[model samples]
Target chain A: GDSVTQTEGLVTLTEGLPVMLNCTYQTIYSNPFLFWYVQHLNESPRLLLKSFTDNKRTEHQGFHATLHKSSSSFHLQKSSAQLSDSALYYCAPSMNYGSSGNKLIFGIGTLLSVKP
Target chain B: GGIITQTPKFLIGQEGQKLTLKCQQNFNHDTMYWYRQDSGKGLRLIYYSITENDLQKGDLSEGYDASREKKSSFSLTVTSAQKNEMAVFLCASSRTGGAREQYFGPGTRLTVL
Candidate 1:
């Protein structure tokens, strides 16, 4: 079974400060697709960044994450936290190549709080 | 841009009753998925369809059934609702599956009492 883990359940940061949300995964599949999804209050989770190539960095909307196969982690980081960046973040692992019927295993989710 | 629409933003049902939730996608994607999200929890896949008339059971498929009669629509049915069962059901679609992003619906909140 594939599993994703987010170490922090809740991360609080002040606006203009650095942000980092940790995500790690364990899967037997050689090529696993790692994804970061952000969910605003009462909204569906939206894809923020995703990558499969090991050690390659993926960035979107001022957020960046790199897939590290050796470390089995895909940590999301942002240079400056924004008031609007407050949301729930989830990390997921896609079963090989994201084919039809392939399911994504998601982590519990981290509640990110940024205070202005 | 395409949208995934789910009928009946909220659903209320009695225990042991059967309930159905419908989802429609204008994306024309071949893959549609049903997921359950509990409060403060991650999304769990309930069922998914690859194409018309095709159905696949997901990790949380027990006590649930899904139908894919058309390419743009997928429906989920709860055979028997249990008391105190409350969660949100989300519908999503992805273009033909190979490493594509998924577009999600607003989600339907279900309450069983």
Candidate 2:
């Protein structure tokens, strides 16, 4: 079974500070796609970004992550933190949906708090 | 732009009672899923249906049952509620059961008395 681990339970930063949320994963798939999902207060989780290419950085909406197969990590990062960035972040590894019929394995979310 | 709608937004039931939650998706997706959200536990997959009448057990499917009566609808039942239990149930749909974007519903909050 594939699994994801987000070591940070809470990450706090002042406005304009840098953001880094560590995400690591474990799976047997050779082409594992790692994803970052953000959930705001009372809102459903939405895809922030995803990547399958190892060492290739994927960026979206001011956030970025690089999948490193050697380390089994796809850490999310932002150059500057904003108050609107406060939310719960989850990392997941891809699995065959039809053949495997398995649900996405999520990390114990990391809550990011940005203060002005 | 499709939406996933979950009924009753909130659910409150007695311990040992059977409760069901309904999910409807207009995306016409081939796959639908049920997930349980607990604080600090992130989200755990309960069940998923790749197509109508197809049922698959996920990691956390023990206490839950799922039915996909139609392509556009999926439902989950909590066989027996636990006293003082509280958790949020989320319904999601994907174009396929493959690696892709999953559209989610607002979620149904459950509380057992």
Candidate 3:
């Protein structure tokens, strides 16, 4: 069974400061796709960025993450924190599409609170 | 470019009652999924369908049953509600491929009394 781990349960940063949320994963398959999703208040979770190529950086909406296969990490980072950045972030490890695999596992999620 | 709608944004039921949640997606996707989101715990897959009338069990499918009546509608039924059970159920749709982005609905919040 594949699973994901998000080390930071909560992250607090002041506006204009840097942002980082740690994400790790376990899976039996190689070339797993890692994804970052953001959930704002009263809204559905939306895909922020995703990467399957190891060491390749994926960026969206000012947030970026690189899937490091050697370390099994896909840490999300942003150059500057904004008030709108306050939300719940989830890391997911997914089986490659259309390969007789159909499980999408998500981590416990990290709650980011950007302060002014 | 489409939306997923979950009916009855909130649900409340008594213990032992059978509850059902409905999900509708207009993304023309080939895959649809149901997931449970608990406080502090990440989303867990309950069921998924690759196409119309297809059903696949997920990690948390023991207490639930699913129906993919059509390409646009997927529903989940709880065999029996548990006392004090509270969680959000999310519906998602994605194209048939590896690692594609899944579009999610707002979620249906359920509470068992």
Docking class of 1: medium
Among all windows of ten consecutive residues in candidate 2 chain A, which has the lowest summed lDDT? A96-105
Error of 2 at A60 (Å): 1.4
Clash list (residue pairs), candidate 2: none
TM-score of 1: 0.93
Q: Candidate 1: TM of chain A?
A: 0.94
lDDT of model 2 at position B52? 95
Ordered by DockQ, highest first, the candidates read 3, 2, 1
TM-scores, one per candidate: 0.93, 0.95, 0.93
Weakest 10 consecutive residues, lDDT, candidate 1 chain B? B94-103
iRMSD in angstroms, per model:
1.8, 1.7, 1.7
Tell me the alpha-carbon RMSD of every candidate: 1.8, 1.5, 1.7
* Pick by DockQ: 1 or 3, better one: 3
Error of 2 at B72 (Å): 1.0
Candidate 3 per-residue C-alpha lDDT over B1-113 given as tens digits, one digit per residue, 9 for 90 to 100:
89999988999999999999999999898889999998887788899998898888887999999999999999999999999999999999988775667899989999999
- The local distance difference test score of model 2 is 0.89
Docking verdict class for candidate 2:
medium
CA lDDT of each prediction against the hidden true structure: 0.89, 0.89, 0.89
Off by over 4 Å in 3: A97-101
